[model samples]
Target: MKPDKSRSGCPDPSTNALQWGIKVKSSNFLVIESDASRAQAIVSALSFLGYRPVLADRVDADETGEQWRGAFVGTVEDEAQLEQFLASLGRNARNLPMLVAADSPVATSLIADDARSQLIELIDLPLRYERLAEAMRSLQTRVEPIAASRRFVGQSGPMQRVNALIRQVAPFDSSVLVLGESGSGKELVARTIHDCSPRRDKPFVAINCGAIPAELLESELFGHEKGAFTGAISTRKGRFEMAEGGTLFLDEIGDMSLPMQVKLLRVLQERVFERVGGNRAQRCDVRIIAATHRNLEEFIERGSFREDLFYRLSVFPLEMPSLRQRLEDLPALIGEFNQRLVQRGLSRVRFAPSAMNALRQHGWPGNVRELSNLVERMAILMPHGEVRGMDLPEKYRGALPIEEVTGAALIAMMEEQPMIADSFAYGEGDPSVLPLEGLDLKDHLAGIEIGLIRQALNSANGVVAHAAKLLRVQRTTLVEKLRKYGLSETVQAG
Candidate 1:
């Protein structure tokens, strides 16, 4: 396949090595580095090679007009800074593949092993101009051009309806409320709307309301002036200012505290907000796209979420269906995830018929997000080979072949029991029917623990070590439970 060219002008790889300098014209290659000198050097080299390079401590490429061709993220030698650097990169590096240049081999090796697959491409220090150029070229090809994602995955009836809704609402500037359970890919739906809308060329910023603490939430949403609070050493633009002309996706909006809700409601109503500690009201031209797993109507009734705010946000409500509600799409989703994994350098892997049948049987309470995580886990955690029914976690082993799980019934199943223990506890027992609801806290906790371990295992694709990390428990703890649960037979030696 011909390599895709980024909106940034492609670098002339055949240029002479001696003329290394930076050329940041109309907006081409973006350079993000901690060392000002190295950044200058890299930029100079790119300029010599007939490519434009812009230098900035950070590049919110989504906000600017230029599509980034590649990035130079510097990982500091200090262990403390390394994590912060990696975390920053983790959040922003999804779109552009990054080349991480570190001062020490140890730091470089750690980043390479951990984050190389996900986003960063690690390169040891004492930088070579040619090597950096090659890395940039390779990355430029990987990033599918940031155009309207013609890449809709699911073809089930619900998804078709979703597509129809997107088409209907794409042209307008109405507030959108995306309702769905966790992991249902509500953000993807939001992106589709933004992509198809008149604001396609503008920024699309997403914030999880629950993720930010209430104390800092105001500044994050509305921005704050320098020295506004204890840690506000410098003025920082809020997500609203950053996403001035595009869409602002407020995820998990139901979790916002009452005070925050009132503030957000004011913004929605007036289309203006004053920066924290600032007297002037700034006008914001951004479109509001909010999503939540909670029932906002119930929250409104309970006086948790504001009624006026909910109405303003829900002007164009779009309900995202859970995975089971769209079971027919599982096959397509699996194929898409598989393709993505392979493209990201994973060995080609496929689910065995029995394994796939098992997948279809389980309640995907986590929705498509859960299913996608499961699929990725299966891809990487499977023993470098085909994933058979026996490869599946215990929860999905034999209830029904994966194929039978579909539609609204599947939705009911997922909603009822999010995991294996939930299934067993809810489904059946010994000689007579048993009531799990009346069970003691220990049994309830155990049931939930087992379910979480199994889900973590599925997320790790049964890799004990990786599964432990997902569970945030020791490897031994996970292994002991695997044995205690009589899951040893399914544990592949990793």
Candidate 2:
């Protein structure tokens, strides 16, 4: 490990650096360029970004085997030397952010090969000041502590509004409808609402309407008396009863069957419900917080969702932002997730500057959940130290933010690794593969809709309303889809 020697103690962009003179601050930076001009560019960019730039021949130790958080490895030529330098950084390499400087051609290779270098930002020579500032802002946000204990971790303006809304409505008992795409943490918002509510002490019961069967849903919701039906040998209290004074989170509420919708509407209207077989109407006391990843309006237009039910559920609506829309929050999210991964026992993975840059650029259709899962997978698979650009999965590598190096080199590498191709083709024989290339766009979309509805229905067990809610569409739309797709034949409860 090399002891860090700061050439210039933390340079303030406003005073020492040029351009818009925006104030910036970064812990430290490493300038690893063999060329003096490139090294100067690296220093100038770091200074503009408000970092203490250090130019060193090699990283050395302070005393008791402790290397400084800041380091700069200038004029590097050999791979073995670079590897040895990174190895000296140890676990600190994963935490202490770095910035690398090399020729234009070498910069790409540096980012791809060195996983231990936690470069928060990259500087291409003849640097653009505005780009550097943006990168600096991103790094600062990721390291700061969040103000609230919300599942959402972001410093972006949209997320700030989200936090404010959670604080405003959390104390109230009004029913909340969380709207967001799949894997956007809608349920997490529901949990936050419950945690902030007056009923925080009570049990928070969560039921995935899409996961239950229509036949058993009624029993699951409204307690069934002994011998209520063929499987009702024993009486059991429903979810609402179990929830009691606490919150009853209905995930995929858009998937409920029409008949069940009527039953549920009646229960909500009167705050009372009878057992499946028994005629005793029990008093209900539970707060409802529902979440769905589908658009309810489309369902209502299709006649599958009741407009009245929508109004009843959405006393307040909380919409979660997609990851792409909140790009500013990527750094913070990456930092938080990295810390969480460490807590969960996987501490080897660390994001290089290029990797983080790639993460921000890619469209995370699956959203935060996908990022979280990918991070976990990376932690498990990356070569023993840090996760760099090349360490990323193949799908992500092609979609990397940077322009790829093509032809012979990459092709030969891919050919050498035939197992990568083999792994991707492992499940090729699955029957679920459906091609919609020739179908009309609307019809193709309809098939997907029908498939999701049917899957939700089967999983919910013939509960049309529950299935509708689970699919995040209206009950009417679900019904229409059932009829349109000939799913009505299989959906018995409807």
Candidate 3:
């Protein structure tokens, strides 16, 4: 028999009469209906509620192929047909939240018998649009975190901690101060915070406090009116104004001068500031996220930084761990870099076990930035090649021994020499035979000093502190000598 095409109210199983119904829209649902009139009515109701509904003649006949967050299936004919439809959906039917409208109590009981029916919300005969809408809203909230976790790529403990902190503070509108060594990814943390925050839809403005000149920093932060200064030919909006409702990331905040800190403090305290030459104060709703490599506490002790501003900016502090501290993540980092290189039309490279071990042992003072640079360099040098330990630079490979002529060894050599007095017979013969070509005494002495310093460094296993201890000199003095002699790289190589 042909199903009724006219849209009609769902018939109550007990009353056999039409009942009142509510319409819902745009909730992207996959709908399967065996009754034409029921399908039309369901489609109309979902369309009115701002939802996209895909109508299917049978559960197994769904042609949309697209994954829907919610599903509504109507009028199951028998247990076998229902089982066939669930089998067609496979894993999705089990995991996806679904609302099923059964035409009879027998059909509902059969559908509930299936293992996949745990997530199914069953309504007999008359459809409950209110119940269906509520189910969809709950499902949407549960799917959000699955999507959010895809943005970050590390599984290390440090990265996990960072992710936890980002999730914790992203909902709040407090100032955050990120601390880390240079190139340790403080900016990435700041960006992640902004991406997950309530103000994500707004702009994110970043400014480097250390890169800008002190004289112009005020104008950059608070903006400038027309004719404010020699170069202020037109009105300009500063970072704070540009960021407005979003985030303003102040990179290298420790480099900001004392005067600028005072001005920033006022802005933070009052949440308003005036243009350089304008009298009207503009209100700001920006969230401040500051990052720096310098020790602000030491700066405060030195009277170069304001303590109150520090407290204000550091309401919630986050420290990015250096790459050295997360060495276990090196393989993943290398793979990511290699994939990036491939995307740029470069051949990918792999690191052998030995090479990876060598990299792990080296000190990465420049952190991730240094590792990235080395990876790029290696990719260019040996495209599509497996890098062995020997392929790495000398500094990363291993330490070299230091060669030196000690005073004791020198004394032993002198004792081995024949007595000069016996060979020179008082003043009759030359006291010592002179070289035909004259040598610069100063140059000779300098060469000896350089050799001794090199030997000391080598003997100390290239540690500046240990070398200084051996030479009975301050580490700073030894460092200066190393720099003067251009042996800094040698020490690093060790």
C-alpha lDDT of all candidate models, in order? 0.68, 0.64, 0.69
User: lDDT of candidate 3 vs native?
Assistant: 0.69
Worst 10 residues of 2 by lDDT: 18-27
Top-TM-score candidate index: 1
lDDT leader = 3
lDDT (Cα, tens digit) per residue for candidate 1, span 226-334: 7889977656667788676778889899999999988988888889999998999999999999999999999989988888888889899999999989988988887
TM-score of 1: 0.64
Candidates in order, TM-scores: namely 0.64, 0.52, 0.52
Per residue, candidate 3 scores C-alpha lDDT tens digits across 15-100 of: 32111222322224666666767766766555545555655333333332445566667765543344344444433433455666
Candidate 2 structure quality by residue, lDDT tens digits, 117-219: 3343454445567765665554444333221223678888888888888889989888899999888878778877877778775656677787778887898
Clashes of each: 12, 40, 7
lDDT of 1: 0.68
In model 1, where do residues sit more than 4 Å from their true spots?
1-28, 32-37, 44-68, 72-150, 400-494
